[model samples]
Target: MHILQPRHIRLKKEEAEELLKRLNISVSQLPKIFITDTALPEGCQKGDVVRMERKYEDKIYPYYRVVVGSLNEKKNG
Candidate 1:
C-alpha cells in the first residue's frame, strides 16, 4: 500500500485516490502535511502519500497524508 502525509496525518494510496474521487478534487488540491511517525508500516517509502480509513462508532472517515521519510531512518546518506 502506498503512503501519504497531508496535514498532520498519514494515509494509503488507494484511500487517497478514493478520497479524491469522493471529494471531487485532485491530490494537489488537498492540504500539505507530513508523516511524523517513525514506526510506519513496512514498504512505506519517502515522498509517497498514503490513504487511510478510520471508523468511529458507525461512522467512517477517509484521509490522506504525505510520507516524508521515516523519523527513525535516514533516506539520504
Candidate 2:
C-alpha cells in the first residue's frame, strides 16, 4: 500500500500568475525539482510548472518548482 506522499500539481494559468505576483519572481527565477519524483503524479514534463504542498504547524504551505532535465542533460558552463 502507498503510505504518504507530497502534494504535486500543475497550476492553472491564473494561479501561476498569482504565485508570481506573491513571490515577486518570474518563472525562470523559480528553482527546479524532479518531475520523475516517485511522490509526484505522472504525465509531468520538463519545463512544466509544479506546485508542492506541505503541511506544517496549523497550516499548509505551498512551494513552486519547475521541472527540469536530468543532471546528465544539463549544459556545462
lDDT of each: 0.57, 0.77
C-alpha lDDT of residue 18 in model 1 = 71
Best candidate according to TM-score: 2
List the candidate 1 regions with Cα displacement exceeding 4 Å: 1-39, 70-77
Cα lDDT tens digits, model 2, 1-77, are: 15345588887768888888988988889988866566656777877778887777668787888887766676562
Backbone collision count in every prediction? Answer: 15, 0
Model 1: residue 54 alpha-carbon error in angstroms: 1.7
Tens-digit per-residue lDDT, 1-77, candidate 1: 33433223445667667777988987676653445564445566665666556656677576665566344545553
Error of 1 at 6 (Å): 15
Estimated TM-score for each candidate: 0.44, 0.72
Highest lDDT scorer:
2
Report the Cα lDDT for candidate 1.
Answer: 0.57
RMSD versus native structure for model 1 = 7.4
Range of the 10 consecutive residues with the lowest summed lDDT in candidate 2: 1-10
